[model samples]
Target: MGFGHIPFDVSHALAGGMLLMSFVLLYQRRVPGLIAALATQGGLLGLAALWQGWAQGAAGLYLTGLIALVAKAVLIPWALSTLVRRLGMHGSVQTALGIGPSMIAGVGLAALALVVALPVAAGGSALAQEDLAVALSVVLLGMLVMIARRNAIGQVVGLMSMENGLILAAVGVQGLPLLIELSTAALLLVLALVAGVFLTGIRERFDSLDVAFLEDHRGERR
Candidate 1:
């Protein structure tokens, strides 16, 4: 009657939801909207982790879900929102690549993820293999988001979204340790702090959050 007793289909569905959010992150343009999407993605990641914990009979993964929900869904987004408000960065997101090209690249990355993960996970259950593929696709898409964006906030969103994908992948593996889960959460927390400091410094120096501005400033440094 516990987590392992539940059907694998449910877990697969939850993981799919997480992947959907990753795609959502790719297309968002507004800083606030992007943060909202990230928060939603984090929430979905928590749900996925919860289901994975139950399905794999790993009690510690429940803690992982809790950390994701509290830290990523709630705290990080809240912090980012405050930063956005303070910086007055509610402007349109800047992309290094156009939207059409970015979407095309995302699709290609997803397809490649499936091709790679499926073969690697072939020895496992169908659900596990598919989950791994989905998780990998999400990770790839998150990286694409980072690459496509020229805005510092957008890049931060991409980095955090990619971390969520990594958590998804870790929870999919049965017998993953409690220490590893805690360690991952701690790492994400540090990343958020570092990103905040970095973003604030950028805003202070250039009075803009565009990464291109940083590049221009680098030339001035010499």
Candidate 2:
């Protein structure tokens, strides 16, 4: 079963929200603000999932929705807050490129994704295949943010954004399998735990978290 009332509208709105969050992520330079944005994006994802659950009457979806809300939305930010504190990071941001250029490129990317999506999607409901396009755009943009940024934290945020986009795409596919989500979540948590330990150890060894310094270390080794 699909969404009951406004399945088309609801799906498009969810896809649009994902795209909007992608744009927001492109320009965010502050760590805290970026984390906040991640949480906000996660909340929107939960809303989208909840809408799907209501429309489809799937009880399991509630678990997925809750995970999006509580784990991605709340727990991640809380963990980041604690991690940043331990690192004594007053303020850190990677500024290797101007924000203006990045925004322009991001817009171009969205346009490209939309254009490319049209031909492949034969035709169907309002968001039948367009949701896939939007999902792909968000994933690509998140990757760009991760690659272009000079901050470790920003890259982490970008990674999380990409993960959320993946989830959004799956949810739009009607009855996507569930076992993978639970398994992936467990692994992701472990990744975060390892990341936290690495962050602390890196700071202790190098006495800094700046990407430039880390690059220099790598250069010296080579």
Question: Which candidate has the highest TM-score of all?
Answer: 1
TM-score of each: 0.93, 0.88
Candidate 1 global CA lDDT score: 0.85
Worst 10 residues of 1 by lDDT: 1-10
Off by over 4 Å in 2: 1-5, 219-222
* Candidate 2 C-alpha lDDT tens digits along 1-222: 235547767767877887887888888877787888888888888888887777778766777888889988899878987888777776647666679988888888877877886666646554657777888788888887887677777777788888888888777766866787787677767877876777677778788765666867677653
Looking at model 1, residue 217 earns an lDDT score of 62
Residue range 1-222, candidate 1, lDDT tens digits: 213535676777777887878777887777888999999989988888887777667888888888888998999999999989988876689788987888888889999999999999888878778888998998899899999999988999999988888888888877778887788788888988999999999889888888888766667652
**Cα deviation in Å at residue 196, candidate 1?**
0.8
Clashes of each: 1, 0
Best by lDDT: 1
